[model samples]
Target chain A: MCIEHKKEDIMKLVPLGDRVVIKQLVAEETTKSGIVLPGQAKEKPQQAEVIAVGPGGVIDGKEVTMQVKPGDKIIYSKYAGTEVKLEDEEYIIVKQGDILAVIE
Target chain B: MCIEHKKEDIMKLVPLGDRVVIKQLVAEETTKSGIVLPGQAKEKPQQAEVIAVGPGGVIDGKEVTMQVKPGDKIIYSKYAGTEVKLEDEEYIIVKQGDILAVIE
Candidate 1:
């Protein structure tokens, strides 16, 4: 639970082999009906900002090509990806296939 | 379920790219503790005999080379693959990656 790490530490993370590191966007504070949800009541957003994309290469005997890039806004599959915490921030690392679509 | 389908009908199954058709081995009737397991009490075994292997090629933008061949005994991941029943027989269709190991 250390919040004292430098931002440089977070930037040092490099995902390998078609895995992309992403930062989940904060959940909407108000519902469509304008009801403000409590902190724990909010659903985890499936939308994320791509932070890093792995290099395209062969993995598990299958050739993979990374299709997304850093700074892209994407929607990912629910319940997919592993969560990683760094420098007081959290990120989800997932494969390119986990990203369902990119938002305009 | 019809029990009159010819064996040729089952042999005619051709697995598509990276998929394999396998027949599950019957669960052991007796445990090492010398207790007989009722039909409903037996656990589904993970081992299966491969009936067909997919032709390896580019699939989903990845190059794949199949490793297992027909008649090979293999262990597959639990909860993986789809079950198909025909003529009083059951088979599982799974990706080659789901086959964890081949028994010599």
Candidate 2:
């Protein structure tokens, strides 16, 4: 999903705590073994666009401030989040800590 | 190692960021099939005593406060930490977030 994916659709799925909901910007991925990898191959996607961000608050006894906002392009660590399915759309819910960098 | 293992000796090692150094509290562990597991086995030990705690401060752009102090017996997630052998004494360094519960 990109910036034009409609904020209203993403707002339907609210994240809890310091979690952020993101949709992968996928590309046809190929593995080092010369095989086409599956969509969920883990290596397939690390880049995403933020769909929604949780309200920053105390999480696990630590003050967390959500640094990334919706529509921000970001890169997350491989295998960092839980894949969530909502209404036929797949989203990855990751803690703010799992986000590696913003793509600017 | 327990608190009786000498706090002075543990002080030699200092953890960085929100990491905590811990030593496993071991027992003769058996697998689901009833085979005794080795000391390094992941299922063998989950209980640990805090050997050292890092100073509370900003880590990874997040403010972290060290909650578990040295000598606090805690239960950590299995396979959660990096094992370090400092001067022949083995210790596991884990982020405080990986600590599950403290033993009262």
The candidate maximizing TM-score is: 1
Deviating ranges (above 4 Å) for candidate 2:
A1-57, A60-104, B1-11, B28-42
What DockQ results for candidate 2? 0.02
Q: Point to the candidate with the largest DockQ.
A: 1
- Evaluated at residue B86, the lDDT of candidate 2 is 71
The DockQ of each candidate is: 0.04, 0.02
After best superposition, candidate 1 residue A96: deviation in angstroms? 20
Residue-by-residue lDDT tens digits, candidate 1, A1-104: 34565654234445655678888877657779999774445676789999888675776666788889899999999987766544446677777889999998
Error of 2 at A4 (Å): 59
Regions more than 4 Å wrong, model 1? A1-104, B1-11, B30-40
- Angstrom error of the Cα, residue B97, model 1: value is 1.0
Candidate 1 on B43-84: residue-level lDDT in tens?
A: 555668899999978877777777778998766666789999
- Local lDDT at B19 for model 1: 94
| Residue B13 miss distance in model 1 (angstroms) | 1.1
